[model samples]
Target: MRYRFESELRRWEARLRDDWYFVDLPPEASAEIHEWADALPRAGFGAVKVVARVGGTSWSTSIFPSASGVYSLVVGARVRRAEGVEPGEVITAEVELV
Candidate 1:
């Protein structure tokens, strides 16, 4: 399934002294992922493999389940730069389970 949503960019400080950014998948999409994942095998940490695109850039990655009952898609430096998105900015992302 393909899930599309817009979300604000957010950042978290990692123990490695680095900043990591991600966007939480909206509840609707998150719920679907949960249902689908429940019936299939997932990667470590309950991550679902997906093909995600933002702006004109796309990559293969995994969205992980968050404590808040949603999934979070990590945005890497390369994708952020290519998409010209920053923290607090709203970005439209499309993710397809693969």
Candidate 2:
């Protein structure tokens, strides 16, 4: 299944003292992903694997659960540079459950 949405790229400090980037999934999308994940064979970290496309780039990643039933898609540095996306910029992302 595929879901598309626009979200602002955000950056936050990770526990290791480095910055991490992500795009938060919408609540509805999060619910759908949670439902799909529940049906999959469990994996470590409880993350839902997916293929994400942004701009002209596509990569494999996972959506991590956050507080209050929310999820966030991590944006790697490679993808950010390739897509010319900066934190706080709104970008359209297409996520396909794999």
lDDT of 2 by residue, 1-98 (tens): 78899999988656547768989889998998787788864456888878899999999888788876877888889999999999999999988888
TM-score, model 2 to reference: 0.89
| TM-score top scorer | 1
- Report the lDDT tens digits of candidate 1 across residue range 1-98: 99999999999654447778999999989998898897665789999999999999999999999988999999999999998899999999999998
Of candidate 2, the 10-residue stretch with the lowest lDDT total is 11-20
Model 1: residues with Cα > 4 Å off, grouped in runs: 13-16
Lowest lDDT 10-residue stretch of candidate 1: 11-20
> After TM-score superposition, what is the CA distance of residue 32 in candidate 2 from its true location, in Å?
1.5
lDDT of 1: 0.91
How well does each candidate superpose onto the true structure, as a TM-score? 0.92, 0.89
